[model samples]
Target: MKTCLPFFLTISLLIPAPASSAFYQWTDAKGVVHMTDDAHKVPKQYKGKATRIEVKEPARLPEAAPPEPGPAADLAAPAAGRGEASVPGGHDETWWRAQFGELRSELKTLQAARSQKEQKLVELRRRRAIFQRSRDRAAINEAEAQASADDARIGDLLNRIAALDLAASKAGVPAEWRQ
Candidate 1:
């Protein structure tokens, strides 16, 4: 039994252990992405869209190697230390999302509002011009006030957008994401 125990130990040491984890990805109805290790946990409706992601075994290295030099490579240095990929300015994907996600949503809504106001503003300007030529004091004042209010509102929206842009630029956010 002692000799058999040694042989079994040797066999166990020689054999590789099977992988114990897996990952699956799916997007929900609200467009939020989800990831889980258990396939059975996913909803029945999402099963068709769920994708199995094979987790590759990390290569066993004797020593750490130096990263290559480049824009992305330079950025990867911080990401490596943080155990994740980052953008140019040492900010990871989650960080960027935290910073810009709500701003992006607000920006979209504001831009739409600005577009509608702009059209109304143009019409107001034309009406204001007509009122000016007619030289009617009360009508002219009302037209001018309406036009000014619209102009001021439009300016405010533009300044807010510009501020968002400036903040993104300072953070080294990508141009595509600035919108």
Candidate 2:
């Protein structure tokens, strides 16, 4: 009995479990079994024994609505009129007025910004001029000092040559031929 029990356990473990599907297997009136996705296909005799398989459907989302008109559309209509505008074009007065207000605000901002930039540019130009003058003065001073130093060096070299000639004369050497 114990050996038979092991065989039965192995056989049960080897058999695969039923797969998940939308179909079901049922036996018809003739006792022939068949698989089908539709429950109505099962014969009346197998309906009682047929197993039901559940199917999950994807969720559907609602569509979006069209956009509404802007504030300008409201402004073009006359005060007394309910649907159409009192004006000839039936345009919304509110929308035009809103646009005009936006333009005026933009113009004011631009004017303010322009004034600020102009003031900044003027100060920068003034500072640049001051810097240029300073730079020019420094260059002139440098050039003058360089010229004075060159003159001093030349004078020193002439004095050295004169001293050498004097020494050659005192030593009884021909100073003119002292190459």
Candidate 3:
């Protein structure tokens, strides 16, 4: 019995373990339900409804590429007759200036939009107050909806402005220019 036990143990150790896989379930727009093991197999229309039944193996990321030669290489090989200050990352001084100008213009436009949205919100609030005083529920509701929409627009504008500022900083724009 002892001899048989060791052999059985060795056989069990030699046998390959079962591979783990994932499954997903989803409902389609037409109210049809589907199940799949592969994420790629799930229908595009039903992607939002997909629920994973099993944990999927984490995808392996590709190895990072080696760094390219820097400003030294650019210095070694003079650009033919291009009278521009070229940076290491292929962005010349002119490009940076242009990008800064564009970003500033966009920032100005978004600021103007935010100002308009704020004004609209103020008007909506005034109207809402008037409607409330006059006991008009429908008008008040409409004003409230408009105010909410304006608020959302203002929020979006603010977020965009913040992102633009971050980008400007990363682009090496002068602090004064970014402001």
- Between candidates 2 and 3, name the one with more favorable lDDT: 3
Cα deviation of 41, candidate 3, in Å: 53
Candidate 1: misplaced stretches above 4 Å? 1-10, 18-20, 60-64, 68-179
Tell me how far the alpha carbon of residue 175 in candidate 1 is from the true structure, in angstroms, after superposition.
Answer: 17
Q: Is candidate 1 or candidate 3 better by TM-score?
A: 3
For candidate 3, lDDT tens digit of each residue in 67-154?
Answer: 2233334433333245546432234444434444554565456445544554555666677676655545565566556545544443
Order of candidate numbers by lDDT, starting with the best: 1, 3, 2
CA lDDT of each prediction against the hidden true structure: 0.54, 0.46, 0.51
lDDT for position 70 in model 3: 31
Using TM-score as the measure, name the better of candidate 2 and candidate 3: 3
Off by over 4 Å in 2: 1-82, 133-179
The 10-residue segment of model 1 with minimum total lDDT is 61-70
Tell me the TM-score of each prediction against the true structure: 0.32, 0.28, 0.33
Find the candidate with the highest TM-score and give its number.
Answer: 3
lDDT tens per residue, model 1, 10-121: 9999999854345666779999989888999999998866644444343332223221222333232355366555454455544444444444565456445544554554
Candidate 2, pairs of clashing residues? 72-95, 75-92, 75-93, 75-94, 76-91, 76-92, 76-93, 76-94, 77-92, 77-93
